[model samples]
Target: MVSKSRSEWSTILSHLVLAAVSLHAAVTSAQSSRGAAAGFLLQTFAAITMLVPGLNTHEDCLAGAWVATVIGLPLLAFDFHWVNGDRSSANLLLGGGMVLAVAGDHLGPEGCSVAGQAVLLVVSVTILIVAVFTANTYGIWGGAMLGVAGLLSRLEEDRLLLLPKEDVCRWALTAGSWAYCRALHTQRLQWE
Candidate 1:
């Protein structure tokens, strides 16, 4: 029991670290793209929510995290366009998907929330594919790491090396946010 408690504390610490990384990313990204910065800010909020006690066990907190992500991804995509000058209609699709996700989370049944998340995940992956095709190396890496984090989130009932899956998820999220910041910074440099 003591070991489990210690593990939980470690998980919380990991989430706190991710929150700090995300906040820093948001601040730095703000200089070149407010849209992307806002996305990172929302991500910071989502990470901070993981620090709340019984985060995984609490439905409300979990929903809050989902909602934040649902709202933030499009903003990130907006910045992706801003940096690359893609000017594609994909951003509209991203925004539409997120809006549906938010609506499902707030207005639909429980199953709707899950469906909404699935939609958002697909949208995120599509954006990542675009990043890869565009040769945005940092964006690709960041998207991959975040995808891993998302996958890990589904394995909350599992444990690895006696540590909760949440810890691994947090670490992945931290790395992803850092990579995204680098991506934004580098791309902004090229644009200027």
Candidate 2:
């Protein structure tokens, strides 16, 4: 029993490590277009592997993670590519990051598992970080959406930041959209 418990914990720890590493690679890749392809590949693999732990033992969480990964990866990758304009990339990343953040909220451990929630929060933040590095205002907005969602989720689960029970995730889809608009306006002004 003792060893089994240890093994389970080891698995959890491994997942955490994978998630963190992938996020790191993603952030690095987003910093610039140079060598972005390699970074994107690494990020993609790491993000998928990160959800492995929740697959067998935590199906619900796994589902959320899978949803987020499947949707977010392509969006993020496409947005990373220059699309004839800065605003487009920013908007795309914002939307993608928001999706990831909200999905992460549902990654709880069958109940009110604070640790599980925190992991999702980290994932969301990582998504936002990538958006920020790769884009501009849209990325910041994406980060904000993730932050707001995380906060609301915490509050819904229990207390606020200090306490927790379940993990509720949200991505200010609305806010991200607004940011995209604002970014476009600013871009127009700069160009003028």
**44-114: candidate 1 lDDT, tens digit per residue:** 88777766666655666666566556667667767776556665644775567577655764565566546
Candidate 2 has its poorest 10 consecutive residues by lDDT at: 162-171
Question: What tens-digit string does per-residue lDDT give for candidate 2 at 1-192?
Answer: 345554445445544544454455445444343233333344345434545644445555455444443344334433433432455554554465555456555645543344334433553465455556546566567446645655565554453333222212321423432343343334334445
The C-alpha TM-scores of every prediction are 0.79, 0.31
Alpha-carbon deviation at 25 in model 2, angstroms: 24
Candidate 1 C-alpha RMSD relative to the actual structure: 3.4
lDDT scores in order: 0.71, 0.44
All-Cα superposition RMSD per candidate: 3.4, 14.0
Candidate 1 deviant stretches above 4 angstroms? 1-4, 52-59, 88-90, 105-113, 116-120, 155-157
Error of 1 at 105 (Å): 4.1
